[model samples]
Target: MKNQNIKVRKHYLLKMAFLALPFTFAACDTEDMLNPVPETSISDKNAFDTPERIIGQVNGLYDAMKDGQYYGGRIVVYNEIRGEEWINRLTNGVTGLQTWQQNVQSGTNEVQNLWGAAYAAINRINVFLQGLEDNKAKIDPTLYTQYQAEAKFLRAVAYHSLVTLYAKPYNADNGASPGLPLRLQAETTTANNDLARSTVAKVYEQILKDLNDAEAGLPLTYGSAVLNTTRAHKNTAIAMKTRVYLHMGNYAKVVSEAQKIVSGTTSFTAPTGVAHALQADVALPFTNYTTTESVFSMPMSDLDAPGTQNQLGYYFNAAPVGNGEYYLNAAGIVNDAQWPATDARKVNFIVTASGNKYLKKFSKPSPFTDYVPVIRYSEVLLNYAEAAARTNDMPKAIALVSAVRKRSDAAYVFPATSFATQQALVDAILKERRIELLGEGFRAMDITRTLQTFPEKTGSGLNAPAVAPSSTDYVWPMPNSELATNKAL
Candidate 1:
């Protein structure tokens, strides 16, 4: 057994001495971006050194991800609000709802928060990589390799998120769009602060490179199987690759990569020797600890609770258990004829009180310490199904999609004749993604990739004079803060 001390070890990076130099930091403390690390006191002497601390730095990277700004909530909440699967009564000062209804300009808080939070995490990962490289001679080769792989995986995740929110979808003009500043090296000097945006193609190229290394480097297991799902492992990198390939519209790669985690030639069975599988009771872990379906989940210790103000539960759950600022879009799911009323998701994943239908997927009472799902097995299945359908593997696509559907409810299972063409199968797979992964921050990307129109929300107490995927409002404007700081953007 792995030492419990190592498996459960947690570190708070923001509270500790961060990359003591701005050269390794993504952005220096400026008037606009968060100066999360007080650079004034940071120095080489205070930065992470000893080999044992490398693991701590790795854990610190998780702390950066645990921020409600990213996995803690906003990422998922923002993605859902932008899609038709949710509704909000926005006049009650719900900026979350307004993110979709009103075209938030470059100056909006959403742009700033999402951009700032993501880079902050990226910078931390960069520092971890730099530190790991420097101390490689002192650390065990096995452990050092794991640390390096996990750090790169986290960095890739951050960049993938950055590009997804700031630039158009990868297929958009084949990634000709401007992407976020791709800072591969650790930033330490002011000269590197005002970097320019890279082409979306270049950003994705780097993301894939990192994930590829992670896939090759991360160990098959992290000793503790439960923690394996929370930390970077071989499957973590593979699952994330599936997501990246899906976003890039690389159907064949998506199918091939997903197959490594899921048993193929057999449709939906979890692969032998792989830990991931569809949870028998899908809702159990959302309120508890890590589970098999989770490839990588954000583990937030009690002391490091994803702060109350921006937590996902606050946005989706009701007052007694949450903020209840939003509710499930009845027309999208509850009343949609395509979705069976008796599905396990509705019976266990949602809650209704005083005539209000709310999604309780992220609900974990006030402190909301529930582990956040980053990439899960079912999603990989959906990705594989979509890719397989598009690549002419009809039986595989139909079986893959049906596996997920039947897991929730046999009644919703697809009929053999349900899809007659590749497009029909793809459409059904996409719908399954919507049903299975709602409120997990996928709707926006799916909409952008598929060029689906915004749902035109009703009762949001907000107005949109205009909305379109091709419009500037579709993706976040480089936040005014970044624009003012990085002139090249």
Candidate 2:
């Protein structure tokens, strides 16, 4: 009887999910790309009727991405805590205690909520894409193409996030595992909720297809630093492609896609679009989101905050500023001797309070309006270096890794015997990723893609067991909401 009641509740919630519209979209002003005017209602009939409405719809897509359950904060926190980097201090269920312990079930709040939010965003994108096609005559041809590209880029990001959490890593059986439902059509009703999961390879195929299409249609640059940082431009798609290809263990494809933006070996920079290069100071990008180094980040402002509970600061910061739900695990990456105390990445981001260390990358107090980084030029460089290492391009790999490391710790140098072989160089680059992307959410993805064990750790009297690749907890289960409605699941 309890199970039947739960199913009924899930089915009803799934139906309601289709009807939840995005926040009111506002037209961009001459000075700002996302000055959203809240509290306005937008009907489907008028969603793409004018240029302003079309622009608003595109902005709406980003707004969806920044939802508390997705990139805004929870996804980032979930990804990090699932790895061995952090210890659950508060053990707050509302945050991610289950995820920290590697015991998340199908009925877990994050499991169900994140899945629902991602598909909601995807469905919204599908609806917007369909609307654009249906009303093509109303918008400029160039604008129409750009908007479609943006939608596809967003859809690709959403699908990628879903797959990473719910399915096996691409390296696992080369993506032979069961994946997401791959919903590409606009879903305004629950009539078509009986879709089956696609193979992981098929989902990745769709992701690459979207990215390739996005790269072709997206503009070279948005002209505004804010726009370039926040919006999907040609380089943005190319950078994302490198990440996707790397996840698939396709080093050749990663190098190919990375070359579109990245140039030179000794000193890497994006030759054409936006002139992306490593920030002289690694902390510069964090201080200001609209920098050349930030390839793409989700924008945040006081008007559109990523909720109190969802703020990254709220998770990793201490009292008077944040709740300090999770703190750096003593046995984690902070213990690495390679990551010296003088390293800017460490000095600037890590804070010690109550005899515990916390990551302060998202340091905005209270409301925590820090722009969540989605991808950065530094990550692109590391991605290139890793792929180059795997492909035996040792010189290029060493140069790229050195460039990234020296940007943060100017005087630091790699050991003489570190690059003795390709694997050694790759190992150093991977360690750099752990330091460079500490709290920015690359931990679990890096772990799973490399097929490493989720290392055991203890905090707050809770011991998280190590999860091997064969463990059922290696990947999250299909959410109960999905199972209740999708008979094909």
TM-score of each model, in listed order: 0.89, 0.94
What are the lDDT scores of the predictions, listed in order?
Answer: 0.74, 0.87
**Candidate 2 lDDT tens digits, 1-489:** 778956665665454344345334343344443453222222465567788887888898888888888889889989999999999987789899999999999899999988888887888888889888999999899999999999999999989888988999999898899999999987655567689999999999999999989999999998999999999999999999999999999999999988888898667889888989887877788878899999999888899899869988889877767889999999988979889998888888888999999888778888988889999999999999999999999999999999988887889988877799888889999999999898888999999999999999998799999999999999999988778767887
Give the per-residue lDDT digits (tens) of candidate 1, residues 204-309: 9999999999988888876675678678888888889999998898988997888788885533555644567877776765855566777778776568787856
Output the lDDT of residue 427, model 1: 83
Q: What TM-score does structure 1 among the candidates reach?
A: 0.89
Error of 2 at 187 (Å): 1.0
Which residue ranges in model 1 land beyond 4 Å of their true spot? 1-41, 90-95, 264-267, 270-273, 415-417, 464-466
Highest lDDT against the true fold, candidate: 2
